[model samples]
Structures are given as structure tokens and as C-alpha cells.
Target: MNENKLKSLTEALTELASAERYEAELILKADPDTVIAQTVAAVRRSFALDIEKLLTEMGFLDPTTPEKCRQSAEAGT
Candidate 1:
């Protein structure tokens, strides 16, 4: 990805991860087996998937060659 797009994606993913972590912390205080806790966990996992999908859509992730994609992302290509 280009520099601008990478920056935007980084910002968005950071914000999303932060918000979800806060929410999970609050909900997880009750009990691990609780419905809310389970829901929060599911949401967290989904957020990761969403991030991956977003990256792929933005041309940052290549499912067929993940190592190359990781290298490109790390190198900020």
C-alpha cells in the first residue's frame, strides 16, 4: 500500500483495537462464561477478521502469498 493508505489503515485499526479492548475489559469483568463475555470475545475475533478483510481490499494483504504481504507491509511499500 501507499504511505497515505497505510497510515490511514494503521490509524483505523489502532482505534478499532483500542475501543474493542476497552469494551472487552468492561464486559469480561462479570464472568468468562457469561453471554456478554462470549459475545465480546466473538466481536473481538470478528474485528480481527474485519481488519484482515480491509487490508486485503486495500491491496495490503495477499492471501496466496502471506509472507510477501507481511514483508511489504513491514517495509511500508
Candidate 2:
């Protein structure tokens, strides 16, 4: 992967860790169904997507491979 992409992935991972920590803290101090908790969950999900995109761009992840495998399996290939 390029330097910039690697940096981005690292930043995303850091942010995800922070969000997870905050989410855990919130869960311990407040109700899990609270709006803030839900928002943190959403933020975590967004960070996961960002990480996935970076990995895909770095050629570390093949997003289409799973779909292709599924299709081939259905076709008995």
C-alpha cells in the first residue's frame, strides 16, 4: 500500500479504538439504548467502513471475491 493510504488506515484504526472506548464507557454509565450510545455505535460502523475501503484500496481485501465465490458455488463451478 502507498504511504498515504497506510497512514489513513492507521488513523482510522486509531479513531475506531477511541470510539470503541467511548462506547464502552457509555454503556457502563448509561443505558445502551440511549441516543448517544446509538450514535457512538453508528460512528464505529462508519469507521469500520472506512477501514474496509482503505484495505480494499491497498489490495489487501477483495470485496468482490466473496460475491464471485457465492455465484460460482451456486453454479456448481
Which candidate comes out best when scored by TM-score? 1
Q: 28 in model 2: Cα distance from truth in Å?
A: 1.0
Candidate 2 segments exceeding 4 Å error: 31-50, 57-59, 66-77
lDDT of each: 0.78, 0.74
Candidate 1: segments with Cα more than 4 A from true spot: 32-41, 62-77
> What is the RMSD, in Å, between candidate 1 and the native fold over all Cα?
7.7
Q: What is the lDDT of candidate 2?
A: 0.74
Q: lDDT tens string, model 2, 1-77?
A: 58987787788678767877776777667765666646766767766677677677777789896578779999999
Superposition error at 21 for model 1 (Å):
0.7
C-alpha TM-scores of all predictions: 0.55, 0.49
- Kindly list the per-residue Cα lDDT of model 1 for residues 47-69, writing each as its tens digit: 87778787887788786565787
Task: For model 1, give the 10-residue run with minimal summed lDDT.
Answer: 32-41
